[model samples]
Target: MNAKILETENVTVSFEKLSRRASELKNCFYCGASLPAISGEHIFNSSWGGSYKDKNLICCQCNFSFSNSTDKAFIIYVQAVMNSWVFKGQRHQEVPKIVLENEYFLDQGAKLKLKQPLIEDEILPDESIKSRLTFNSKSEAKRWIEGDGMATWLGRLPLAEEQEKLKKIIIETQLDRTDAKPQPISYQLNLREQYRSTAHTILKCLGFFLPEWVQGDLTKPIREFARYDKGDWRTFAIETKELFPVAEEATRILGLGVHHNSVEVYWNSSTKIVVGVLTILNRLKRSVVIAQDYSGLDSILYVVEGTHGSKKPPISVFTEFAQKQFSLPLLSVQYFSSPNNIYQYFHDELQVLMGIYYPIDAMTARLIQKIEKNNKKNLKLDQVSLEEYLNLFLSFFLDLAKVASTSVDMTKARSKLIEYGFANLAHQHVGKLYTDPDVESLMTLAFERTVKDFHAEVLNAG
Candidate 1:
């Protein structure tokens, strides 16, 4: 069967007063071509569980082209997170295949399977051949035995007499289970393409929610960077030091059985810059420079729950329900200016992305159960014991991938870890198996070592 391509749905409702004005997207937002008789363009990739779209913002040519280029890159980049979340988009066929080190596949329900089937035959001293077989599924084992075992093992086709003997051996073989090791995954992200796609997302959202600014001259820089790769992609959606605004509120909303997708367009009057932030599956957070010297809407928060069977309209803070629930914050007036500082921001983003496999609740439950067991034994769980338990917990559950390779600066990552109360404590408890050093340097060094061991290289598309 063919795998399902990610897809989204068209949305017609608008937010606040923007709903009153007619849409001005007569031409494609990216190529300026006449609108095609195709489905709307998704603001967020459907692979990231986005359901909302705008029918008039982009033509079929631009839409199909992007679906094959930068858009596809963005989807592939986040496949690990999407699969870990068990998030099925509007048309997801099955969980994506997340292979680690080219040997194991991460299956649904937090399980792992060997990609290659294993078969072993050993001749005993008594001249008897002891055979063993392993496969990811029973069907695979059955196919191999019935289709190829006769030629491979016996060196001849299994006739009526030999077939009975082979069948008897297969029926008598006992079943066993396979265990998987916790190894670091090696993966790459083309930052150039990812940022370009993120910038594209912001622009698409602007066309859908704020049609008044869709064709403004001030939007030229962003449009060129997103569509034609005209400028430095880094400058368009620069990484900031903080999480996207109102992230806490968004997390709460996501916990209620929905994957969150949102686009925040805010005008920072102090800096005179209009910034756009896109959050997908509440995992990827990107901020982009939409326009400079702006004079438009002060703030527009567009949120949609992206999942199957969701028919609710998009949410805006201007609505009474949203105003009471979400307290939107102003976008940052500035981002880190230095390259070293910028690289640290990306490292932090990688850490957040890794949270997709961090089973916090399950780990918490295990820790609690351990403590309770110790209590029943009348042995107090001391700090040392707790720390050792945590080390094991992190080692067992956190599915890590080295996303960056170039050495920039660990100073900022160190400081951020300390700021989050992870300095001395975390260094003593976590990452001991990988870095075996202090937490400050361990944070960066371990990630580099993990990737190096797997022979993975992450590079910029430029």
Candidate 2:
């Protein structure tokens, strides 16, 4: 079965409807203050390529404060991810260069100074280096170099007399090989600040998405967090988990488009709280769940898995009378392909709840079978293959629907699939083989037919 493509028009309509509802409110949703003036607020920071905005939600003062503080933090966090392979594929923004390290290294038997910045290819894992470098600014780098430190076993600086000899050797070495391409230097990443900033940004965005009537309930704590008024901001529990090996390996071969960063927020009726989760490339996951009384001063923070996993703690929600008044679905753990497929379940559920159609396991399985049969290959579909195929099929559908674009080279796309372990399938037989106008037409027809058939089957079964 074909996955439904989320059109840009549909998204615009949804936001417009929400904005209209928000405009009718008398007070700012965030500050609970009488709105002297209201401004459009992007739920996701505008700096990060997000265009969706809600006019009439935030007061002018709150909007300015958030844009400078919370939004700035969010931009820093996204900038770090911009250097990552996964996020780079999905976003088209000018990425700022990040200083990775400052260190003394050996070049031609002489100690040389090097300051490493993040390079695109460094996202892959390597075990050759033992220690990482950290320098926040130019002054920091200068201070470390000026300070008297013991030389390591790698090498020590030359004495005053030896310096002249070493300088000659370094010049001779450079003169000999001027044609070699420079290799990217590797360094360890310290993302503590970026992570903190991202977490705060996610919480603030969640506030904007909550129903306007319920938003006032969140005003106090959110404002405090945004303003950094509370010193114990770390009280909010946050954790990051590595993606499964297969998914990770596939990402390296295919680059970041295999998965993208996403934010999901849901009202937990049982707990009488709101939960928001931010998943980075579906690899690193972080969540914040907050509960506040009517006064908002008496709020409690709980550490819960924003997504599902066998190792992750079960999500908690309290079933109280007032909480049940909302018609929203109570956040529940719905197992998808496997226990490891945790956070994606809730993400997909949010899409469904928002009237967006996503491909189910059955649909994905059927698509895989069709592809295998068409290619006359007896390929075995594993968890990783399933994910890879699902992404590819979804992207193909979106491209057909004119909602998004895909790489034009069918051969390259097919090679990525094979590299990710779909070995048995014939590349020529997959998805019309060539990306010609006629091929696109055939794909569109095939996709529409499959989706129609799947809907019919579901209706008949019901």
| Each model's Cα RMSD | 13.8, 17.6
Q: Top model by lDDT, which number?
A: 1
The residue pairs found clashing in candidate 1 are: none
Candidate 1 deviant stretches above 4 angstroms: 1-22, 90-92, 120-132, 138-143, 150-186, 241-244, 253-258, 295-300, 309-313, 319-329, 333-462
lDDT of 1 by residue, 57-88 (tens): 88887777777668765564356554545556
Q: What's each prediction's TM-score?
A: 0.61, 0.39
Q: lDDT of all predictions, in order shown?
A: 0.56, 0.38
* Collision count for each candidate, in order: 0, 6
Question: What TM-score number comes out for model 2?
Answer: 0.39
Worst 10 residues of 1 by lDDT: 318-327
Q: List, residue by residue over 1-462, the lDDT tens digit for candidate 2.
A: 112222342121111111123445566655667653556655444445344455555567766765544455444234333332212221344333433234422122111224432122223366454433333334443344434321222258535454454334334542221111112233222223333445444543443333442354454564455444443444443332222222334344534331333454444444455544555433344455443332211111111221111222112221122221233333433212343353455344343421121112213333444555543442443444444554556544333233112223444433444443334333333443433344334444444554453334321221
Q: How close to the true structure is residue 171 of candidate 2, measured as C-alpha lDDT?
A: 41
